[model samples]
Target chain A: MSILEFSNVSFSNEGKSILKNLNIRIESRDYISIVGPSGSGKSTFLKLCNNLISPSEGNISFNNKNVSEYNPIELRKEIAYCFQMPHLFGDTVMDNLSFPFKIRNKKVDMDRIKYLFSLFSMDEEFIDEKVLNLSGGEKQRIALMRTLMFTPEVLLLDEVTSALDSENTLIVENIINKLNNEGSTVLWVTHNDEQSIKYANKLLTLENGEIKSLEVLK
Target chain B: MNSGATLSTSSLIIASSLVLISLFFSYYQKLNLEKETIIGVIRAIVQLTIVGYLLNFIFGLKNPFFTTLLLLFMTTNASFNASKRGKGIKNGFLISFIAIGIGAFITLFILVVSGAIKYEPYQIIPIGGMIISNAMVAIGLCYKQLLSNFKNKREEVETKLALGADILPSSIEIIRDAIKTGMLPTIDSMKTLGIVALPGMMTGLILAGTSPIEAVKFQILVTFMMLSTTSIASFLACYLAYKGFFNGRKQLI
Candidate 1:
C-alpha cells in the first residue's frame, strides 16, 4: 500500500519557488533516501510531508486520504520528522525520553524504553543524568530513541546523523536500518552519497527544487 | 511646613533634570530616538499629570468604589501594554489579563490579609501599581524570548514533534528558557536592591517623613512581592503564550 504520496506539489517562500512541481510516492516499508546538494529544497520537501509548511500548489495524500483534510497534529503522529540537530529537553535523560508519551496522555512504556536504551548501549543510570551534560552523540541517540517510542507509520529523517561521530553514526544507522527492515516506511534526507547508497533501498536525487532522478538500489 | 510654592518649584527642577539627563544618555549611546523620545516625554508628562491629580482625588474621596475602579484601570492598562508589546502572539490579550490579574490579586491579598497594610485606597493603589507594572515587564520579556527561541530552534522543535511528542512538551524547553529570561530582570533588581540602589518605595517613604529603618522595611516587602509576582506572571505567560505559536493541530503558525 502507498503510505505517502505527493502530487504536483509546489512551494514558494517570499515569491520565490523553493520546490516546483515535485512529485513522489512511498510504499509501505520502503526505505527511501533523498539526496541533494545544499539548498536543494530537501529539508523543505520533508517539512511539506509533515505539514510544517503547506504546499503552495499541489496535493499530498496519506493512506489515500488527502493530507490537507487531516488534522496537522494527526498527520504529525503518522509521519515523524527528525532534525539534523537533536534538541533534548528537561533536566534528566528520563525526562526527555518520557516527554512524548506524557504529552499525549499515554502511559510510559518502561519495557520498550529499557529495550531501546539497551539497543543504543546506554546504561540505565544514564536515565537519571541531566540532558544538559550529555555529549552530541548521546543527545542524538536519546532523540532517536524518543522518536521511535511511539512507532509512527512513516519516519522523516532530516540528516539526523549529520552531526554525530563515525561510531555514533554507525549506531544510529544500524538502528534505523533495523526499523526499516521491520516494515517502517522511511524517507531520509541526506547530502552524503555514500550513506545514501549504503542504507537506502531506493534513491531520489534532487537538485534546484526538482527531482533529478529516482532509481532502485542495485 | 515651608512655602508650598518653593517646594513645587524644587520638585519641577528635579524632574526636569532627570528628564534631561536621561535624554543625554540616550543620545550619547546612539539609541534609536527619533520618534520614541518625543513620544516618551509626552507620555510621561500626560500620565504623570493624570496620575498626580487622580492620587490627590483618591486621598480625599476615601470611597472603596472609586479605589477599586482605579485598580481596575491600572490592571487593564498594564495588560493592554503587555499585549501590545507581545505582537505576533495570538490570544496575547487573554494571557496578559490572566498574568496581571492573578499577580496583582495575590499580592494585594497578602498585604490586606496579613495586616501589613490597611485596606485603604492609598495602600491598594501603590501595591497595585507595583504588582501590575512588574507583571507587565515579565509578560513582555517572556513573549519576546519564546518567540525568538521558536524562530532560532525551529528544527529542534520539529524533531521532538516527529518523535511522537505533542506540541506542548516539544516546545517545553523553549518555554522554560523564556520564563527564566523573563524573570531575570526582577531577580537582578532584588539582588541589587539595597547595595546598588534604593527602590522607589523606600525613597518615597523617606521623603514622606518615615525613618530610614521604616523605609527599608517597606522596601523589603515591596521587593519580595515583586519577585513573587514576576515569577508567577512570567511562568503563566510563557505557558499560555506558547499555545499561540502552535495551532490546535500541533502545526507551527
Candidate 2:
C-alpha cells in the first residue's frame, strides 16, 4: 500500500480554484521534489499532505486511511509541515525546541538535540540564546530543528531554506537527504530548479494547480 | 436658591434650559449639531422621567419575580449589544449571553449572600445593572482582542498546531493576553478612582441625601465588584470564544 495517496483531490478558497484533480501515490522513502512558478499551487499541495488544509472535494488518504479520519494533531505530527518563512515563538531557542516533547508528554533528549546541532553546524550553547537575537538563517535552522525533535514519517517542507545562505542551505539539504536515506518520505517544494533535482529521486512539476509531469529521476 | 432637599418641578424646568446654551454654542460655532443636541436633550428627559416612575412603582412592589425578570431583560439586552463587537466569532450572541449571564449571577449571588445588598428590586436592580453592563463591556473587549490576536498571530498558532499541539494549547497564550487586555481598563480605573474624578454612583448618592462616608463605602464595594466581574467575564468569554477562531480541522478560520 502507498504511504500517502490523493485521489481526485480538489481545493478552492473563497470560490476560486487553487488545486484540482491532484492524483498521486507516494511510496515509503520516496523523496519527491516539487517545482513550479509561484501560485502554481506548490505550497497548497504540500499543505494537503500534512492535513493542514483539507480538500474542498475528493479524498486524501494517509497510510491507506482517509487523512480526515486520523486525528489532526496525530496526522500533523506524523506528516510534519515546515513553512517557507520560519516563526520562532517564546523567549529562548530551547523553548521552541522542547515544544514537541512538551506536547507529547515525553522527556526531551539533550543528546538528540546536540546531535542535530552538530549536523546543522550550530553550537549546542546557542539553545540558551534568545530567539529574537538570532539571524534569519539561524531562525529557519532552529525552526527546522524544532520540527525534527521527533523524526517524522513524512517531512513536508515548503521552501524551508528560502532565507538561508548557500552554506546553510547546503547544510539543510544534506541533513534532509540524510533523513530521507533513513526511510522518511520527503516532499519538498522549491523555486530553485537546480536544487529541486539535486537530491530527490523523483521530480514533479505543477502548473496552474495541475500536475504537468512526474519523472522518476533515480 | 431653593431650600428643598429635592429640586422643585419649576426649578427642574429651569435647569432644563441649560441645554439651550449647548444649542446656542453649536449654532454659533457652525457645528451642525443643534438638531442633534435638541433631540438628545429631549430624549434624555423623556427616558429618565419614564424610568424614574417605573423604578418608583417597581421599588414599591419589591417583588422578587419582577426583579429577576428585569435583571434577565437587562442582561439579554447587554448581551445583544456586546455581541456586535464579536463580528468574526460564530454564535457570538450565545457566547456573550452565557458569559455575561454567568458573571452577573456569580457577582450578585455573592453580594446578596454577604448582605452587602438585598435581593430587593431597588437594590438588586441597580447593582445588577452595573454588573451586567460592566460584563458586557469586558466581553466586547475580549472578543476584539481575541479576533485581533488570531489574525496577527496566525503563523505562530499554526506553527504550534503543525507540531501536534491541540487548539487549546496552541491558543493559550493569545487567550491569556486577550483576557488581560479585557481586564486592564478596570484595574487602571480603580487606581485613579477618587483622585481622577468622582464616580457617578457615589456622586449621585451624596446628592440624594446619603452621607458622604456611606457613599464612599458603597463606591469601594462597587469598585471591588467591577474588578471581580470583569475578570470572570473576560476569562469565560475568552475560553468560550477562542474556538470560534478555528475550524473543526484544527486550522485557523
B54-126: candidate 2 lDDT, tens digit per residue: 8889989889998999889988899899889888877888988898888889989999999998899888998
Report fnat in order of the candidates.
0.60, 0.68
lDDT of 2 by residue, A1-218 (tens): 58999999999999999998999999889999999899999988988888778899999998999998899999999999888889999899999988898899889888988998998999999999999899988999999999998999999998989999999999999999999999899999998888999999999999999999999999
lDDT of 1 by residue, A1-218 (tens): 88888899999998999999988888889888998888899989988888887888999899999988887777887788877678786688898788768867889889989999888877878888888899887887788787787778889898888778787778878988988888788989887778898878899989999999999994
TM-score of 1: 0.81
Q: Lowest-scoring 10 consecutive residues by lDDT in candidate 2 chain A? A: A44-53
**Pairs clashing within candidate 2:** none
> Which docking band does candidate 1 fall into?
acceptable
What is the interface root-mean-square deviation of candidate 1?
Answer: 2.4
Which regions of candidate 1 fall more than 4 Å away from where they truly are? A68-71, A89-95, A104-114, A117-142, A160-174, A194-201, B1-50, B91-94, B113-119, B212-217
Which 10 consecutive positions of candidate 2 chain B have the poorest summed lDDT? B1-10
Model 2 Cα shift for residue B176 (angstroms): 1.2
